[model samples]
Target: MSGDASHRPLDLRSDTVTRPDETMRAAMAAAEVGDDILDGDPTVRALEEKAAEILGTEATLWVPSGTMGNLIALTVHLRPGDRFLAPALAHVVEFELGGWASFAGGVPHALPWSAGPGRVSPASVRASVPPSQPYDALRDRLLCLENTHNAAGGTVTGPGEHRAVTATAKEAGLLVHLDGARIWNAAVSLDVQPAELTWGVDSVLACLSKGLCAPMGSVLGGSAEFVRAARRLRKMVGGAVRQGGVMAAAGLVALSRIELLRNDHSNARVLASGLRDLGWEAASPETNIVLARVTDAERRVSELHRMGILATTISGAVRFVTHADLSEKDIQEVIWRISSMSP
Candidate 1:
């Protein structure tokens, strides 16, 4: 954050931009590793156990990305003709490449909640399925919920809301999976453990890289048998890793930095308030992501980069993400840069 501060680009592009610091690198270098495929890597096992403990699941498996983790959960829950349900704008359906249909052979059914875009009520979820169906019918079978929903401006689904939806799914005999890639942010913002928001769900996935600042990997946690099946599915999808403890050592450090996420949430709120003060309408972020209304978002993002303030164009708005790598000085610099811009 010092020395040539003016030359540094305010990279509010995404949390994924963060690079591992010295402590993480040191852990990675000092990791005890082995062939993870044949003989499991000791550090990877430790990290997986830590992830399971954090998520309050029976077991956990380390995977390559959030997409693969979610996909594995999907394929494990639904079959070829089964119907899967999720919020209309969920990353699993929108961002991930039709993996349910492509890999799992399941069909997708989008259900939007009455409260807003990223929520679904018990009644609504119940209504999405049939009251009575014939034996020949292939009915809705799975539900996936995204906390701190990406396209919905990172809005959180509290434990109550999460339970409301999941309760309905349970009544309908439907399995549930949580796309909790940003659950750490939600937990920090809500002042609750991540496991509290995930109760009753069959499976859950959280990323180690985003906001957590690990260079790579995501962890999927669920019942012991669910994780065992996921491991085979992971291997089938070419996500297997040997000597993975090297990267997992960084994840071990990432878990230790959970409390630090509050800073990103704080920075996000500050950035949102600053944008509003400067006349751009920005959503007050509940977590680390800020979605702001801007004229010509593509042009604004380009100009922001020109001014050394980096962002992304999302849903016709300029998206600014706060991360562990961004310091308070960086936030102020970004605000100054934005205030100086015409857009």
Candidate 2:
């Protein structure tokens, strides 16, 4: 980032910063809500049903955020002291403040990213399980996978690998949970149904706020029995709501526009390519995140901030994320400004 270094506002931090559009705001205002915890919110139920159908699950529960949804799945799948495996730098292990351990009472195991960036091999999943022991052993009970993995520059896990790894976990008597916070991006990038990436998982969570432009909410889907248990866990974790339909309304609108993420993916590639041409080591992104390796992360980030371009660091790389909020022209302008920055 060298040259003029002039201020030109653009935010490439995370897709979660996307704001609801007018249609979503109107839907939220008009949404028919009820006491979700006491009785039930009709709009919330509608969002849950739509999410379950999209994810190919028996049922769904709307939660306040993807983190809570993942935690609920973890608590439902594991007993205290049980172990769960996830890919290295998975949000479940690294980003969620250790709730899997502190709240779900499960031990965490990180599998290497041998399959690819943000992907774990089926062999690794099998190898992670402990063999029978003479004395008490740490039970490996769950395998968690992330789609459009965050720290890996939003790298995607394809449907075939998804099925293979989930099958391996099942064979090893381990339940599968997918932290699909950005599954919408994976589905669009792979040209596959979201369910294709989630097949065979005991539980899967998808975020409404990420790339969907919803204000907030995530849907957790699974077998009816599993969701029945998750509902109890949700309340236990203080995730239950009263008038959640306001948020669910925006989620409904967001789902209707999921195809829009294709533009974000396109913009991300353009940003990475542009940055690379400007002497930055920007990785070619698989989805909407570009991880550019730079000399001084903190200093370069501060420089980017001075130019009014926001970004965050992940795995020692500067990460720039594209979302519905940004257009191709905006991305080009961002690159132009970076190119204009002083050396």
Candidate 3:
């Protein structure tokens, strides 16, 4: 369960590397299949329904990836030439390759927030709305947010913050969309229901591929009408899989195991604390991901690889993610390997 031999495969690279286990494979094999594009796969439907009920949304739709889910939601919520506001570090703004503009013809306006590590606040949202620009005048239709903001080292947006931000958007007659790809991580860290973070948002997209241990897939949830529109967009974007019960089966297993995400958070904290003890500058992880700064980022990564560990370097920091497959022993091994390297 390590990484490729060229790299020593402790694989702290990303949570996406997690593989489905025997239970997931068995579920896929036993899943009841149907033509999803036409009649709807029974397994897919069940997963969608379960997600909707869990998130307290009216309905949900399964898409191939969180990118597709977010894109589809944007397409449904906005018209061509429309604009949306989000934190400068938002995944949709920084990581998604301007898909909002290319696919949905929507414009993204960056809202300034506390730099380094912080969530967008109500005051920031209110101030970002141009004084001369009325909600309708600017053609801005949505306010997008990410929980466990990835680029910020997995910081969780609390319920109060979420309510404040969304409420401000609503006052300005704008809809709120949550890019909650790591929301389950936030829920586990905050000891709140996932619905608490998503309660007032117009639409939400949560990924099964990240911390949930699903092979691949994401679910978009909102009003029934919005989900219906997203389904059409899904097909238009070539994201409609004919018989996706195979993936949906794994998603079902992910839902059942989501409650265990706290373990990943605990492991991340332990790893971060250990790295700090080694004289590395590591942030206290609020969820499954940790970012540690080393003197020579590339050399440290190479050294870690030589010592049988895998990780990613971003903005001069090495990123590590913990998942169901990673245990406390693995975390200890990672700490030992990195500590063995001299500054």
Candidate 4:
């Protein structure tokens, strides 16, 4: 969403578009790095420990991307040809390029959002589990959940709801994996610790490159045994990095500023409120992502792009994500520009 040196487009596509601030850049430059796979990068280990503590897990492994983190979790949890359940339109279902099927060798069974947008009911999950069937039936091995679910305009599943769903899966003998890429936002919005929402899940992945605004990295956390296994799989997938502390250092800085996500959430609410005032059906955002229903998402998005506001379409809705790089003034300007658009 860059225009020129003088006119930078207001990018609302996703939080991933955020650039590392000077603090992050300085940390990266001064990072003490080493061979992550051979000798173990000291800073990478520090990040893993910090993330694990935040998520209340026994251990954690640093991966190059959230997709890779999810893949590693899938590989460890599912055997080849096993089936796993995820909410329909979940990032692992709609995004991730079918890595669950092709790479992880697991079947994806999409659960309807019966509880609400981007949420699945506990009863629905219980019903999805096959009865003590013959050996030929595909085994359901894992349940994947997303907090502040992306495609649903960043709707949050509260700690109680999270426990209910995961408890159901666990009772049915399924391991749970939480795609907690935006868990910090959810925590800030709910006024709870990030660990509260992750208590019942066996493993969770949190991204540093998204709202936290680190350069690039995600951490997967679980039991010491689970992470020990994931470390091997991470290396197998060519994710082994030597001197990875440069990025992990930025992650440390990002973690320190986790509370700052409240600003992004506040800005998103303002953006949605403005869109609603313009006669668009914009839902009140629960976090930093806003979804406005439109007759033609592609056309609306294109129009916005031309007006120097970058946006994307998700499930026939215009998607806007607020992030660290955006300010309250930028939100106001976006509303003004959209209001001036031709009908």
Candidate 5:
């Protein structure tokens, strides 16, 4: 996606592929580092504090990755043998390598979802809970939601959806954990403060590495007590970075570039439109991800890669993601190339 070489094709694989810009590199070089687990790195502390403020939470803890952040939150929220509810395609259920069952000792209960990618409803939440009989276990103790849902093609979870589903979950005595790895995209698409999107959730995970272009870092935010427990779980799971200031420095730079996400959203829309023009069924993107229907998705992904465009195949569709590295011109070029591709 970079202007590295004229022959290089546009890389719409994933936003995670974005390389840190010069500003981020400079910040990392000049970072004020410390023994993070021992003495507390000032940069890491600053990043956590800023994340807490942004999410309107009492405290936050920095983790090496989004998966770790999410698992830590789940571990803190649920006890062993407990079950949690989430949409069928939620990353925690489908993508997390069964960590909820393995490490958190939690069982996943699937909820009905759809391609609108906004399928978690108040009714669905109520349905997840069983009748409160004395003999009933009421195993469902948590509810997980994803914003700008990845497998559903980066569709957004609007504030209205947040209120309805979260309120219902709380009423059913279920704590909510938001998998907000791409909440930045949902915020940009909805034109709302990030806090507004996360309000009412018991805990939230936000990533600096995706779309924001930070090399590595994700933060989980919640009440002070929740974060305190999450910090212990963080170390228990081997996520305690000793000198994490280098990554935190880039996270600071990433926060400063939040406004630019709008550009990626715009590019994603263009890619979707192009797919439609090419006779493929492409979902209208609400953020930086485009999921286009492909007759042979797996084969098409390989072909696209050979053609110099990298994309991912998921659930019988090809997913194209836009990021800081790809330009508007790059999107157009990719479209033209796809149009000329053989049937």
Candidate 6:
């Protein structure tokens, strides 16, 4: 059965697998273009404008990746030798290869968030920023956060928590940057408009490639002056692309189809519930990613591969992300395969 099943492809690796659908392909094929580096590409400009409006910001810039978008935003917000703060599990702190230190020339003060689901408390922020002995003078230049925090099984931080955190950051005169790679999923799961969650944030970087199904792109949004500065930082980091509208066309389709993300979140919950039923421990997913723990995680991953299911094991936890292309049937099949596995 496993051999025969190998002929079928049920990729649950990550939402990043979602390819451009027919409409996206059509848009890309017909997209008008210009030298975005010199004279901004019209399609890229439209996508940036749409993203800015959605994020409730004054302006936006299109970048090639969420990493680039975040790096540019951080560099724009902080100068060399400055310091930024975030939860220890934040993508920029844990996953971005220390770009904040290397590219932005800033130090990271990774404060601990709530353990299981990984939430940062305002008190933690306050304590992390208060002057300590030795008088090191580590000024807090920026506060970074992630929505539907990836390493936390896509947990959604409520708007109240967001406001409290941002309020603290603002009171301290620190600029806040949101790593909203899955902001759309967070909004859908929390049943709030995206803008409401981002209203207090100084700047935001959201990815078009993740849950939105764009082939590749991310938008950095903030005040007009901030975005202008980020644009220069993007070019300085070699992120400027010529005639990039081909990718931006797919991003347009992603924005128009973003409402469907609720379906992905629903499937994620279903997947987590099923894993629980199989006696596998899974975090309660509030968005489109689920984290499950299996005994001898490395061995379990190999077994899953034999069953033709793919997932990532992060520190003994396997991550399963739902995407637009995965059907309910595919989700069920994934659950069934896991059920048959013995630790």
lDDT of 6 by residue, 1-343 (tens): 3446554767777899999988899999999999999888999999998988888999999999999988888888888878898877788888889888888899998878753365788888887776543556766789998887888788878888899989988887789999999999888888888888797887898899988899898999999999889988888989899999999999999998778998898888899999988888986688888888877777777788877788877757888889998988788888877777764
Candidate closer to the true structure by TM-score (higher is better), 4 or 5:
4
Show the colliding residue pairs in model 1: none
lDDT of 4 by residue, 1-343 (tens): 1224215589999999999988889999999999998889999999999999999999999999999999999989989899999998999878998888877899999999999999999999999996697898999999999998999989999999999999999999999999998999889999999999898788999999999999799999999999999999999998889999999999999999999999999999999999888888998999999999989999999989987899999999999999999999888888888887653
For model 6, what is the alpha-carbon lDDT of residue 59?
A: 92
**lDDT score, residue 159, model 4?**
90
lDDT of 1 at 214: 95
46: Cα error in model 4, Å: 0.7
Model 2 compared with the native: what TM-score? 0.96
- What are the runs in model 2 whose C-alpha is more than 4 Å off? 1-8
* Model 1 misplaced stretches (Cα beyond 4 Å): 1-7, 134-137
Indicate whether candidate 3 or candidate 4 has the larger TM-score: 4
Question: After superposition on all CA atoms, what RMSD does each candidate show versus the true structure?
Answer: 1.9, 2.0, 2.7, 2.2, 2.2, 1.8
Candidate 3 lDDT, tens digit per residue, 254-331? 999888898889999999999889888888898988988777788877777777788877667888889887889889
In candidate 2 the C-alpha lDDT for residue 92 amounts to 91
Give the winner by lDDT.
4
Question: lDDT score, residue 38, model 2?
Answer: 91
lDDT of each: 0.90, 0.91, 0.85, 0.92, 0.87, 0.85
lDDT of 3 at 31: 90
Backbone clash tally for model 2?
6
